[model samples]
Target: MTQQTTLHAAFAGHVAAALDALKAAGTLPAGLSRAAVAVEPPRDPAHGDLATNAAMVLAKPAGLNPRALAEALVTELAKIPSVTAAEIAGPGFINLRLNAAAWLDELRTIAALGNDYGRSTVGAGTTVNVEYVSANPTGPMHMGHCRGAVVGDALASLLEAAGHKVIREYYVNDAGAQVDVLARSVHVRYREALGENVGDIPEGLYPGEYLIPVGQDLAREFGDKYAAAPDSEWLALFRNRAVAAMLVMIKADLALLGIHHDLFSSEAELQAAGKPDEAEAWLRAHDLVYDGHLEAPKGKTPEDWEPVELPLFRSTKFGDDQDRPIKKSDGSWTYFGADLAYHFQKAQSADALVDIWGADHAGTVKRIKAAVAAMTGAEGKPTPFEVKLVQMVQLMKGGQPFKMSKRAGNFVTLADVVEMVGKDVVRFTMLTRKPDAQMDFDFDKVVEASKDNPVFYVQYAHARIRSTLRKAAGEGMAPSADHLELLGEEELGLIKLAAQFPRLIEAAAAAREPHRVAFYLYDLAAALHGYWNLGNDRPEKRFIVAQDINLTGARLYLATQIGQLIRNGLALLGVEAVEEM
Candidate 1:
């Protein structure tokens, strides 16, 4: 069993013992259930390692004074093997101090588990689909998409570490008007590459210079043979080629951020290849799709507003604010229709579905969730769908706002940020903030070699441990796991922090907030760094003493465990745990 389970079991045993003692002493009502009893870490560490609310919860239910019940429970808990002491204080809290040997055992478990120390089977092999960074394949990824990519990738890794069979997916928006604009953009570039003065790109078309090579490829492939043909005949070919090229560029951009999707579901493929038809049939079978007209959006007026009957989905019946249309007035499928079909396909395959989208799509959440519920006929019940909306990231340099314009072709690409600060730093910094909160990415501060830079601080702690190991090896001292018991107070404190890793993973995965991992790593790194700095003042506190080889060996073992944990945590964030600065 994991250390957390063992700790929980020990706490449960204590609670059980306390309940029995209360019954035996006749200080509490008989047959009172101890189900609400809980043992967790105290907000203040000085109180104790673990605090129980047994008395506080049972006071009124059992018709006993909280302090009197706490006192009796403390006496009962003192007999437990894992709990060294139990004290009753402040009305009803039963603070239990664990035996040092329990922590030592935890250290041994961590050492045995090594990199897998924090892994959990909470997901129990269930299938989960994590769709993220479904950026339109019309250009390279911009800075806005970078944060979502990192957050999604980290969340997938976090869930996988919790033992879920996760499939990372990316949706390709290839059948939309965006791709048509891309085709035109590439055609402009093609003419320019073929010695023709394309002049200025037309309004409402992509004008980025990145498409120059794509145009060159198009020119080389067709050689003006289809230039005279109508757009209908050549548009499809050009759109496909441009999308393929754009997707390649997009993949490269994701690679720069250390992200790669397992599946790339295409919108055009779904429509042209019978998937949408299948989805529509499924929805019709469920009585979710029908022919109707939607009310124009309220509280806002559009210049080209017109009312017309259209094919609609009864999203309101499933919990949306109102029914949503699946087809436009002109008989073309709306974006929402394709989205519903995509989600339908996902729901059919996976046990759970999670979509990571930008905050701009905040209004889209209710409609999508409603669509999922309507299709499944699971209204008023929880569905296996979660939408993680990531707010925008504002990039800054030296405390000033930094803006990039793609129109000017001077936008900060994902590649630019990754190339400047590295994939590890970029990933780590992006996740330091919660997904729903806006994040500020400062180019200068992120790479600074100081404590203010959390990425460097955590990495420095890991590197310091490595440095200690190197010093021990140079001095011919053994650094094996067997000598871990000789660890000092500072070393043991670090072990306690390491023991919390599995619990952290489980909590972060259950909460669906990967920022918890970042926070936990920061705390663990701080503990290690604090202990490392203690060596600066006291010679004996040094991990490698000149004359104490046995002590050095034990300290090295502790340091190795810390290094392993840092490496594992960094791996979860898709960050590199470097051995050197």
Candidate 2:
């Protein structure tokens, strides 16, 4: 078998070189733009090895019919060393078949690169700020926040693999009304800790009993110091303390899923630093904000709805249905007001900003985008601000909805799910579907070892590869490229699947969907398992061919490369690749 360089990159280079030759030979028009030329594997494997759309894309511009252009390009492309056969297929598409050595060379590249096989430089030098799992620090994280946390973390890893400088961030909503309720709830327990009968938790306050510990801690820290003080005197002090404590609990819950943010931006801190005031003044000067009366929002008209003149952001000018309020009737800054300031601050240092939010916040996406546009004067242009609305997740056990938690709160805590099925299983299961689609996380199914369980199927494949390698090593066998020709079509098929890893990473990173990596790993695992099953019926296909050490070494090398791919993919998803079941 002949040697080759990287598959996709090599083919792309050949296509460019072929186009340049066409221009040089005067057969095609000089100055023809090669931007539209694309080389990719054909959808159907039967259509040669790789396909190009150069003919179709440049035909009209070259003043030649597509078929004519294809014929001309085919003549030059067939001269390349790797192109054993070049043929024109449907509608001017040129399919090129490479020699068997090209596929074998790809396998060699995977083994040499190891874990860095799929790393790409598509996003090199770009700074991306991914803000995810910004669950209000009012209590422990619940099941609703699980998917966003996993997706955000996975996307951050994927971007890093694509050579982007990524910062994983969490926006703590400490200045909001929810934190006030949390403070009041903790204050009730604080009063009870001081030997006063605070009675049952009042309505409209945080009813979760998790605050009992925080209340007891506060009591111990300041023994009855402000137990009888008015809320005006203790609200700020208690709010600060409660927010700090709740953030610790939230961080612990995230750690249960192996998620840790590089930064935790606080709305309270931003406001305290005068960022919101500065943003407001900047918007007013730009005429993006003004005093205006707002129409009643569609569908739900509040009973107290009135045309009160408030400081309004002209979101409608940028595509929102109506202008949005920056301050409420009570003169306090609204949540959106603080969010705009935070996003603007983030945009100062980042080339791109991504926010992972729950689907319930879909309506706010457009206005937030509009606010970023107004702040940066990037209206009608591509702005770095993007909000990914993650649909909800339903936690299940067996065939029914699961709802037991140590906190006994309205939703199951993330820590509870992680404790039940392990961090790897929880993270992998959450990523099985796209963020926009709702999914059910079944506790029983996720832990199963059957093929129906994606996580188990993938982990089992990696473990089986590792086990085989260990047994091979026990017999003094190691991976070698000397006898790769012993591999047949079945083995080459597996290598082809592995070769898609780099392309997959680039596509998934550009699309900002890390779930694709999980799906690709599942497919690769299936290829490994299906090939292994063949050895059950035909012992000759077994990896450990005892009679010939050279053949055994080649098969072991193939198996090792597959394992490396699975491990690299699982690492991106923050899931551990197990060596054993």
Candidate 3:
């Protein structure tokens, strides 16, 4: 698709052209780095519509006084066709105000693009592999996994909106002690299904009743075949089936949140294919891995822990706390070792990699980062990889801790929470805060209809817009750009807020923070709602002025674009634009 230039993009060009003109006139030197120069909304709305520090940024390099440079930029900036006022703020900052036509032109751009209005081309030609919700395939997905799943899925969608080809992936950790425990737990349930009193769950085995169904299915299929069999005979089979069953449950839980992955990479398959061995051999050959004895961990004593010489990755070279082992003493891949290989495989196919992990895994982040850098650098092309840590969500109901799920064994299941609120509420509320901060998913607040609830407020704004449009259509009125010149300053100001979506998308994607999209949409909704209230007291400000057909069309058109922008932003967060709150 051909990219439409946003108002921010257009004005950015005007700023660049003004600087280029300055250089051409011998007022500033050519070839100086202009990367530091930025054109953005001023901090205080009273200052101007848009502001730039071009004068301050280029003055020292150009050998001119800041005040003199500001005057020259303002003089050149005022010559732009759409720019109406250009003035120098304190400390040589240049602020430019555009005529109504400039904003009207942006309103038209929104109409022309429709659904693709805020889509950006900044991430064009880049492929990002986003891996999220890599929970162990041993139990049903619970609240612990919910936040990361939503964050990761939304981030992937945000990146795609920013013009990157994104591969949504989930790493299934099937080869581990946890799965073995799950297999054993399933075996116990299988015996219980065969009419054996397994009694209370044996210590060290999964105690969740969620495993009962898998066991019952096995009992019906195999009769008493595995019930009396040895652990060696049924352990692997049960492990595989149990993991598969848990994954089915996990997928179902994620589906409720409207999340799905493009790939489900298996840790077991990676080991079966010798991928970890391949990584280890390459690391050893490059001197990044060596047979080294690890230093004693802090506060450990002889009775508690002992240092063992093993195949350790020299992670300290990359600023990690210490070297990390790739393999345990028993010749099995350590978690980091297997994970290193997993990241290596991912990097082989994508331009960059992103992992959304629970904050509990923060300690491992440094070691894995160092390992990726070392292994990928050895190939002479280091891959860009980042790990975003999501904090745990504290579920609250009735101003107290919510009850746990019986099906999930102990913790609250994601499906249960989703069923209570809904997919849209679950997904949108998850992004209401930064991922790294502690968040409370209060059942009451999330479903509250007050503006204090962000999802409700944003959705209510869209619903109001849709309701207005339907009313207009019933009255034989429709949106039009023909009378936009009659749109007042307040209307244009509302359009300016709506027009920030494209730039917001680019900035949020670059920062890999999808929460910013949530914040921006809330502010935009507030702006639209505030403008709609303007009509309550002033009849002329109402969207449908029956006596004035031309003005009514233009006002309706403005409301339509604002609604469209909210829809676009909501789509990025995996939220449905509600027609009725």
Q: For each predicted model, how many residue pairs clash, with residues at least 3 apart or on different chains? A: 0, 0, 0
lDDT of 3: 0.90
TM-score of every model versus the real structure: 0.87, 0.94, 0.94
- lDDT per residue for candidate 1 within 1-581, as digits (tens), equals 35445444446566877787768778887877776776667778788887889999999988778998788888888887877779887999988888777877776666777777788787999888999999999888888899889888999999999999889999999999999988877778887887888888888888788899988887888788666667887788889999998889999989988899999999998888766667677777767788776666676466656678876787887678788888777777789988988898887778788999999999989999988776654454444888999998899999999775544264678877787788888999998888899889999999999988999989988888887777667767857656666777778778767877776787788777888888888998899888878889998987887787777777777788788889989999988888888
**Candidate 2, residues 1-581: lDDT per residue as tens digits?**
22234577777788888888878888689888877687877899999888999999998998989998899889988988767999999889999998878888898888777788888787976999999999989889888899999999999999999989999999999998888898888899898888898777898988888889888988999899878889998898899999999899999989988899999999999999989899999999888899988887676577857678999999999899889999888888999998999999998888888999999999899999999988876454545778888999887789798768557467788888787789999899888998999898888899988999999999999999999999999999998889999888999899888887888898899889999999999999999999999989998899998998988899999999999999999999999999998
Global lDDT of each model?
0.82, 0.89, 0.90
Q: What ranking of all candidate models by lDDT puts the best one first?
A: 3, 2, 1
Q: Better model by TM-score, 1 or 2?
A: 2
The residue-by-residue lDDT of candidate 3 on 1-581, one tens digit each, is 11367788887888899888999999898888987787888878787778889899989988999989999999899998888899998889998888777788899989889999988787976999999999999888888999999999999999999999999999999998999999999999999999999999999888888899999999999999977788999999999999999999889889998898999999999999999999988888888899988877789888988777899899999989788889898989999999999999999999999999999999999999988888778657789899999999998987898776567676778888888899999899999999999999999999999889999999999999999999999999999989899899889889888877888888899899999999999999898888888889988889999999899999999999999999999998999998875
Error of 3 at 580 (Å): 2.1
Which residues of candidate 1, in runs, are more than 4 Å off?
1-40, 51-80, 86-95, 274-287, 297-306, 377-382, 403-410, 480-486
Which is superior by lDDT, 2 or 3? 3
